[model samples]
Target: MAVEMEEKPVIKLAAICGSLRKASYNRGLLRAAMKMCRDSVIEGIEMEDIDISELPMMNVDLESNGTFPLVVEEFRHKIRGCDAVFFASPEYNYSLTPLLKNAIDWASRPPNAWADKPAAIVSVEGSGKSGQYHLRQIGVFLDIHFINKPELFLNAFEPPKKFDDNGDLIDEETRKRLQDVLLALRAFTLRLMKGKSY
Candidate 1:
């Protein structure tokens, strides 16, 4: 009998965190999502090198200068190279964070990195619904095929500190919800990669 090795799907995921706060709930949500999906069909991306804050505003004139900002180029490249994107956002004053929005603004120019890509949103904050709605608005203009089900809205302010310094999901229920979302997102990406429309 011959032993055969299983092949893993080459799923490149670009995770963007909306908040730049040192202890942002949104970043923690991404961490939770990655941990929960370790055994799933898709691989989670840890974009630790990219700085969302350094991408500057959406200025075409500035972009047309001598050189493009490394952060902007890297962000667009990540989105273009990846099969899907997972946005970990926080609702600040009932809207998406500025840090994440600016990064998206820069990436959605000229070539539009998010044009027709499969994407998912996760928000961990006091009001999860608010974050979700706000993020949806951005999804509309970017032309991102946002996932409609298995939403992960972690209520961090309620009970059980669901994250620590490194943004790890501490609660069991929250982890389960993140896992469910990842599973759905994995299937979503795979289907999209296979040329299937959702």
Candidate 2:
């Protein structure tokens, strides 16, 4: 006799890369994750790279009558729809990239789009390590619950080149570590959904 198996609910993830460069290592990490999901290597989750390049500099003047610009609204909508977030960013001058902060500000307006969402960060750092930490501080006020284990901070300049000319992550060890972080995020998100944090 055939038996029926219960299916798990799919977790929707919105991925954001701080750098806007086409050949950014941070961006490559996000793409690799999406591929993992497509290949079933990471099951029960769907991730979409949400582009914030179109958002203008955040300003209250832009919000008249409690309405934001079209691009800002769209970005906030994406954040609101996601069950969790996957942030791939590189620290700049002991802080996060301006591109990322601007996007966060826009979504953090009158209605907080990131409130209570589980999120994770995969950063590529070379000595200056304040970027991800700064992001974490921001998350506290935004109410974004970030997982506290298996942080993947890649040193792109280290031996065994992590990426090729295309900026694709080719290092097996890095991929494995990144996978671990993603799995952690998935588990944390599930716990949040079930209202159990253990």
Candidate 3:
């Protein structure tokens, strides 16, 4: 039996981009995704950007009296509330960015916001895709379930020039691929959420 929209649980996806560059192509991918959701290019999912740029570098000393800093608390809260995660990861020395690692570390503390959550990753990079793999490895300990197929890794400097000067996706083909990643993430998230109250 087909599930009605109202009966099926609404999937919430929260995205965090690795690169903090103002005109980063990775950030552009995430922006395109939010636009697609707003325009109904993808259905049954509500996507939001979770800012990790403001997150401080990990320091055990930052924890005071069993409480985190205000910004860390807010970031952890958002990750905890989302049904799944979308990572716009860009390679840096064949691994995830330090900023992203910091965010994950904060959230993976006592309560572990990422535990048992479904996740998907998209990237725009030079050559090495090892960054994506590095993230998946981290996900193992964090319990972030990632969808295996339909991975997105584009050459941002390729001939077509898929993004504009201000870091917005400008090409239709890349937009479609981004949409595909979102749809797959949504489906995988729903599958994990089935028969359970999240």
Candidate 4:
């Protein structure tokens, strides 16, 4: 007897963080996201593997030279290759951290790569409210089809401690939140891919 197989939808997601620190809460949140994503429609790409520190800021000379920094080029290529993005950002003085902002700036240069992509934000901070506003501002400017429902904010740094060093999510509440965001993001990504507003 032959068995039928389920068709898995290909949904690529590029994840970025607001901190370069090895132990950053934002990166921890990204790890949680990776844990939650479904195998059927999720492919999570972390930014750490792509070196962005070598890339210069969005400068005229860089473009004029017709040269693409391997890191920046990989960044844009990932964005272009993906169906959506998941930004795991930390709050810095009630704003998105500079590390994440620089990433956006670099990706949004002339010949932008972020336009019209469906995106979502999952912020982890000592205080959740502050991160909300910060992500809102970024969503507005990026023109991404930001998922409005099931917004996630890991308010306290303590929650991530439930997970192990291997980046597994252990806290029940945090795990549930991760599931909620993935479902919401999947719906949002599907809506955007279908050319419908959600």
Which candidate number maximizes lDDT? 2
C-alpha lDDT of all candidate models, in order: 0.74, 0.92, 0.90, 0.69
Candidate 2 — which residues are off by over 4 angstroms? 1-5, 196-198
| Model 3: how far residue 7 lies from native, Å | 3.2
| RMSD over all Cα atoms, model 2 | 2.1
lDDT tens digits, residue span 64-98, model 3: 98789999999999999999999997999999999
Backbone collision tally, model 1: 0
- What's the true lDDT of residue 105 in model 3? 95
Clashing residue pairs in candidate 4, if any? none
Clash list (residue pairs), candidate 3? none
Winning model by TM-score: 2
Model 4, global lDDT: 0.69
Residue 142 CA error for candidate 1 (Å)?
Answer: 1.7
Model 3 misses residue 151 by how many Å? 0.4
Model 3 lDDT vs. the true structure?
A: 0.90
Candidate 4's residue-wise lDDT over 62-145, tens digit each?
Answer: 664654677788888878787878777777887887767777888887677888888778776677467657667766787777
Candidate 1, residues 1-198, lDDT tens digits: the string is: 999985546666777887888877777777666654554423543333245767778777777553457777877887888778888887888887778778888878878888888878888777648867877888898888888998877777787777776766678887777767777877787777777534
Ranking by lDDT: 2, 3, 1, 4
